[model samples]
Target: LRKSELKGLEIPGKLERLIATFFADDTTVYLSENDDFNDLQKILDDWCLASGAKFNIGKTEIIPIGSPEYRDLLRQTRFLNSVDGPKIPEHIRIAQEGDAIRSLGALIGNNICQVEPWTKVLERIDQSLDQWARSKPTMEGRRLIISMIVGGMTQYLTKVQGMPKEVEEKLTRRIKRFLWDEKTHVRINKETV
Candidate 1:
């Protein structure tokens, strides 16, 4: 009927310090509008035990869960890079030949000039997308689509410019894989009611 903190436990003290880094043990009081005493008490007990912190049963109360008033707060919160799309620099937002070549090299786990042409191809794709976007707003989707289109064009340009055959072959294989992934997707259309 009364809350109690487990005392005389040194091991638990050390554990509490360690877990506190990852979990919170803050006091949050709630009062239930409905008679869900059984469920609420069980929840309090479970959380108290699991968290290695004593729940002040005397002070604990369950309230009806309601939505936060500031519903749009989440939209303005700053988030980590992982939460944001593609971990690339802002300057390279559009794929440039230099960026593409770097990405191609990155893909094949290579550096140096092995995939320079591929990088140039990526740069062209980026430039082309920018041009298309400026000319037609609806063509925004063409950004990714043009990458595949220009991959072939840039590869041809690279050949005319006389890139190494081995490098060419490697870039071709890498771009093919990239295009295959982008072009090949499952389309699920909804049946009308």
Candidate 2:
């Protein structure tokens, strides 16, 4: 949608003046600054009809951001706190502040800076490492797996979010330990591997 038209719409807050990001078929409309859910839905419907592209309401979600006070305000004024909103389509979901929404293989939410999504990835890595340890792979095999599979899995996420230093350290420790057959408190000589 055009910024000029959205500005004219009767929506609360500064989002009306904000421009939407359009990439190919995906259009990201930021409604976090406004609490006008009904008006926004109407605009989306009208846009979909005019563009001849169906708006997949089922895939659409309202992800609220900001502090507790802002969240409360959004809940009270925008009807996003509750799961039920008569004005909102039945298929559209409302994601709470702390809820994680998977987008492009990364977890996104209001507090994505915390790297909560990495926890899931860490768990999966742990499981895989455990299985690999039981199989007793050779050092060369382990190195290949770590450099290829594990590294590949996290490459996009690291590039996107840059991951927190602590999370990267933890993953490094885990990988090193796994490489050493789960040996703890032992130094690994990099040149040997």
Candidate 3:
């Protein structure tokens, strides 16, 4: 509940002390090496016991964040990586670099500009286009369809996290090609719907 000064946690290149993120039943706790995991788990277990909810250790993971070199160091020292290192709970594994962890609906990994995050949305867009391809809707109908596709950026799946420029262009090209029923998607110019 209280934000304590995050000490001994050398995760981010630039840090923001300690913080806990809660989304409904799921909880993410950020801590440093100096923190006592046993005590923390006990508190969480107590909370879970009182709340009639079970702590799902199977879904728990240790996500290492920082510069690549710093993350490597954290990985090297992980209890899994080093038997002599501090022991972690069974079923909990440290995430490797470039691993995409699906939190809520977002695919998050080490790279911020990665296209992976938009893969699902792109799939949905493609499906919509495929379904609409057979229809002989008017030009205005195509424009509305394109508008819905664009609106996905603000939708819950994406949540306004801007995608890579390449992805934006890919979406534009595909939708435009579908609008004009053209074979070469890239050939659809901006002036043509």
lDDT of each: 0.39, 0.68, 0.67
Write down the worst ten-residue block by lDDT for model 1.
Answer: 73-82
lDDT of 2 by residue, 66-178 (tens): 67776666556555434345444555676676777766555677754466768877888888878777888998989987887579768888876668888899888888887
CA deviation > 4 Å runs, candidate 1: 1-112, 137-152, 157-193
Model 2 lDDT, full chain set: 0.68
Could you tell me the lDDT of residue 107 within candidate 1? 23
All-Cα superposition RMSD per candidate: 23.6, 5.6, 4.4
lDDT of 1 by residue, 1-193 (tens): 1132312113444543111111254443222222233444476688778888786554322111223321122122211111443222222222112222222123211122544555656556555555554654333344355555655556555544456677556555544444333345535443620
| Distance from true location, Cα of 147 in model 2, Å | 0.9
Best by lDDT: 2
How far off is residue 98 in model 1, in Å?
18
TM-score of each: 0.21, 0.66, 0.76
User: Which candidate number maximizes TM-score?
Assistant: 3
Q: TM-score of predicted model 1?
A: 0.21
By summed lDDT, the worst window of 10 consecutive residues in model 3 runs over: 1-10
What TM-score, to 2 decimals, does candidate 3 have?
0.76
Q: Which candidate model has the greater lDDT, 1 or 2?
A: 2
Total colliding residue pairs, candidate 3: 0
